[model samples]
Target: MAHPRQADLAGLIDALQAEGVEFIVVGGASAVLHGALAMTQDLDVVHRLTPENVARLATVLEGLDAFVREPAQRRLRPQAAHLSSGGQLNLLTSLGPLDLLGRLHDGRGYDELLAHSEVLTDGIHQVRVVDLPTLIEIKTTAGRAKDRIVVPMLLALLRERERH
Candidate 1:
């Protein structure tokens, strides 16, 4: 079955876009795009969060009463399975549990997120999405128990890519 979450991801992108949080879909959803994994619950986005990005988001979320603040904790690794704040879903800065790609690219091993993202239709709106190569990076970086279930599928496709 096509991942149900894929459909909803557009909405999440719209929400963040409305909030002025410029982010790319870079987690599980990214994996799905690259055939590295399947559906997911929470939407994982990589925001630039540069001073300008932060300021823009502040203005957008402020109107909705939704707040954007630095997520507590510093270091983040894909290997972690749970959020420190106790929730399956959350927004992260530089924290683990989101399986955020360190660097991203379109084809090859991990690089930078920008390297492996593409734009997709987010409902009526268009949004950027992470490409497959980056999805593999996130999976490798995250290295979680669940990842074991996904790795085989990714490897099968990756090996095919290597052949040519």
Candidate 2:
């Protein structure tokens, strides 16, 4: 069977939603959803790690042919046990680079982020994307150069959202 293009992030989102995986689209993708002009090669998601939710996530990962993205361990397939234990999973998948985060830098989980998220459509499924302000917080806390570059843009988007 054919697979989605490597850059087809929306296809991954649609699949995750279909599998009932509880996740919040965050990082650069969330910023883009809120109207920021930015480009990201990966989809960053914070997922709920409840055993049931992790099971659903594993099912999706299996369908996507997901495996660890790290160079040395790229062949290792994701297992439910590992996903359920949950920290961060950076996987190169048939769909794309899917970053599954179990907790935020500040230790917030999926439920917390979901409480503050909005459902945004990927031209297919209504995906839960983290709010702009929260996205900014995550980026700032992370303090990576790439994230720093986008902080101002996210702040501007937040302001723009507030004014409208």
Candidate 3:
């Protein structure tokens, strides 16, 4: 198997927006932007998976390369949408190895995605990103090792919020 590379940088997010493919910017990249997390090479995002959006994203990504799906296992994962380009990217999310890999966890949709989002601008294009507090909530709910770090930091921030 090949190592995963980062997907959806600011520039690419901008580009994806232009293409009209809806995605939410989440994980460490968004956390860094929100001043609650450090920099990250990988990018994670969640989208409202409807039959239409799924078909649209697949068509859009098909122009790039093949899309792959992995079987479900003992992991808090989501459906994934990946670019087949070997030198390019492999988007890993709660969404899984393919966008429509499995039903979304509790069928979380665009509204939930929007509820916890922060907007970021890269030049003229803007992207919606998941903010720190919500990211901590989402990641902690997922309960991954990397996400475990979000707990203490978030607790500190919450304490700080209360102190003020």
Candidate 4:
């Protein structure tokens, strides 16, 4: 029952990149960065699915003292295999909730997402954030109630970006 305080996204991004864990920032965080005017407590990243990358991610997770968020597996520690498995991992780290997605719907991985991403620099650290169009595609495909709720906002943001 250890509820660690949420770590700032900059710190998390710096840590992950410092560890050489290849990933792309996605979900609500990306939306907000792309001017969607949304809020997200958790950081969602689509990590690369290579053994070396997974190993790197595992190292970063270990350093963060990350554990599974699921009640049934809260005590279970994450492993490199989890990253290599190509799915989503809901984890709670000393920093905060971090969702590591190995792939998105229909098995789109880092390479695919990265192709449609933009590098965002926060003065200290730089990370690839999914572009607004692709993020909209992802949200539309996800089709969850939460994902659906943000589509219009994202579309509006996209239109605004296009106008400028």
* Index of the highest-lDDT prediction: 4
- Model 1 — which ten-residue stretch has the worst lDDT? 77-86
Give TM per candidate. 0.55, 0.90, 0.60, 0.91
**Whole-model lDDT for model 4 versus the true structure?**
0.85
Per-residue lDDT of model 3, residues 21-77, tens digit only? 666776666666555655466555564555656555555444434333233233322
Candidate no. 2 TM-score? 0.90
Cα lDDT of model 2 by residue, 1-33, tens digit: 233324477788889989999899998888877
Which segments of candidate 4 are over 4 A away from where they belong?
5-7, 72-74
From the highest lDDT down, the ranking of the candidates is 4, 2, 3, 1
Write down the lDDT that model 3 would get: 0.53
TM-score of model 1 relative to the true fold? 0.55
Q: What is the lDDT of candidate 1?
A: 0.50
Model 3 lDDT-worst window of ten: 95-104
Off by over 4 Å in 3: 1-4, 37-39, 69-107, 122-124, 154-164
2 or 3, greater by TM-score? 2
Every candidate's CA RMSD: 9.4, 2.3, 7.6, 1.9
Tens-place lDDT per residue, model 4, 1-164, is: 46454546777887899999899999988887776777788889999898889989999999888888887354688877787999999888878888899998778899888789999776765779998899999899989898899999999988887899
Scored against the true structure, residue 7 in model 4 reaches a CA lDDT of 40
The sequence of per-residue lDDT tens digits that candidate 1 reaches over residues 13-36 is 555577766667766666665555
Off by over 4 Å in 2: 1-6, 72-74, 122-124
* Angstrom error at residue 101, model 4: 0.9
